[model samples]
Target: MLLESLSPLSGMINLVLVLLSVLTSAFTAAVGVGGGVLMIMALAQVMPAAALIPVHGMVQLGSNVGRTAMTWRHVNRAMLAAFLPGVVLGALAAAWLLVRLPAGVLELSIAAFVLFTCWGPGLPKRALGRGGILIVGAVTTLLSSLVGASGPVVAAFIKQSQEGRLAKVATFSACMLLQHLSKAFVFGVAGFVFRDWLPLMLVMVAAGFVGTWLGLRLLHWLPEHRFDNLFKWALTLLALRLVWLGGQRLAGAG
Candidate 1:
């Protein structure tokens, strides 16, 4: 009967993903990064390949919106101005090219990019002025479409501005919320029906809000140095798994 239903996933797997969404949200809230990527990695295991990005985008949109609401006062308005236009441009471009990517390529590319962001060489420390931030917005948003989550990339850009932790987290959440909103709009206009997934997505989002609250509390107790190390190591291991899985898929396709 589980298999006979019209649900996008079996009841068991759906329940598991809902739980994982909470846990992952907590992880990111505590560490200031990694939750979205981790959630996508888990979803990739059971979600149909074609539905992955859009569904992931919607969930992240909700997650980040919740975070943005919590940290609204800390957001950087100036940076937001520079970043939004690029988001629109990037979303439009992605909408036009929304052809289904080969699953192997999509997975492998995301894995490689995640690893690069986690362990890759640091970008030059120069301040990217308005024009520069705009460019960062465009480029990273474009990459986000392919990879589903590019928090690290956007965070790196925000870091360059040398904002303190609260501003950094708040601004990052605001930027991502806008970007994800743009992505969702593009997907909708592109004719991807999202109605069926709405029920599950709403549940995951409610769970994510709970996780975010708990994670923020945990963050108050966690030292930055230890959290950073743990976050990177965890993401690195996940990336390696993605690489292996992606490679296997590619080989099978060949």
Candidate 2:
């Protein structure tokens, strides 16, 4: 009965996505970022483009919520407070526009920014504070609404901070939670019927929680230096892939 309800997906596909949710959630929880990007890339292969962003946003919303709950004690309250207003503004702006940008252009722009954040000169201390966070919040949230996964961009911005590993993971989860929440609202208003996907999303979210728990355990065992290197290289590789994909898309369009 339940299997019958998850239309447009065979039972095997549903099982695959559920397992993917677990793996990706664990990846993000331990490594601090890139999981959502990976998950969306996988989903894009199977899901219709029209349903892709909203469905992925819903699943990520659950994954982030689970991570945030588990690591709530380590979250940076000050940064989150400063980021809220920007989230509101960004969501509102996205709602007003309601137009999808060219895929290649958005992909290239995001990849460039992620690479720059990973390797470019660090921002001054002041720029890493409230004002900078506010801008990051607005811009990344806006981008997420269109792109389906802005976790790497958000993680890259947070990477500039001097917080310890746990705090960084916690804060990134919190920020992504808010971003995905805004995405839910925007897509809801845009007339995306989320009910159709609710059952699968719920199962995926449950699997994600289990993955988050295991990943947090791994996070504790990893050394700070190793974590830093892993995080950086993971993001760099993902960004480079985006660059390649974006170039291919542009060539095809041309």
Candidate 3:
């Protein structure tokens, strides 16, 4: 019963998930974003439905921590400083409310958000003050607790604030790391048992570290314009997939 609860899949499917983790992490590392969404999408196909958010959160927490550590010098300390207060407020609110999403709502909402961040008229480039950053942080953190990955939202805000690619990636990774941290804490407070899947998560995180290393190497060779185009296309495809998944689930229920 313990094994069944922890790993609903056969050994082969577990191997596939670990491989997916590596590829997804590397992809995120190279393009400076989109890996966590990809990983969760794939995980949803294999893992038990109940474990999706918490397991994904832990895997991304490890992966982003790796990316942030590798590029710590480029992180925007001022921005993170402003974001922390909002994260605290958001986590507290999420824990207190204990909001459980209806089946299709979370996926569809994430799809819409990803599309907007990828293609919609972006937020103005003006640097947000502390208060603005705080609000953004709170909103993203709150949403992330529900959906599992808020990388696109965090990326959009970080893109507006930072000028260079390295700065953007570094700071964005830092912000996500913190968001995952908040999520883990919230789940713990809410009585989600994270230890059930610790073994699989550790293996996936190790694979993600390798992927992040390879992705960083590729990041240097890829031209900026080329990377931008690839990033946009990848995000669009993922968003479409999410929309389809949500629609199918809703249709089945109706």
* Top candidate when judged by lDDT against the true structure: 2
The per-model lDDT (C-alpha) reads 0.76, 0.88, 0.80
Off by over 4 Å in 1: 1-6, 98-122, 125-127, 228-254
Residue-level error in angstroms, candidate 2, position 179: 0.4
Overall local distance difference test of candidate 1: 0.76
Off by over 4 Å in 3: 1-8, 100-117, 125-127, 242-254
TM-score of 3: 0.85
Candidate 2 vs candidate 3: the lDDT winner is 2
Between candidates 1 and 3, the one scoring higher on lDDT is: 3
Highest-scoring model, TM-score: 2
State TM-scores per candidate: 0.81, 0.95, 0.85
Residue 111, model 1: lDDT of 71
Q: Write one digit per residue (lDDT tens) for candidate 2, span 1-254.
A: 66656646777788889999999999999999888988899899988898899989989999999999999999999889988988998899888786676758878888898898889987778878888889889888888897775788888888987468899899999999999999888998899888878888899999999999989999999999989988999889988988998999998888
Q: If the candidates were sorted by their TM-score against the true structure, best first, what order would they fall in? A: 2, 3, 1
Q: Please list all clashing residue pairs in model 1, or write none if there are none.
A: none
Ranking of all candidate structures by their lDDT, best first: 2, 3, 1
Cα miss at 145, model 1 (Å)?
2.0
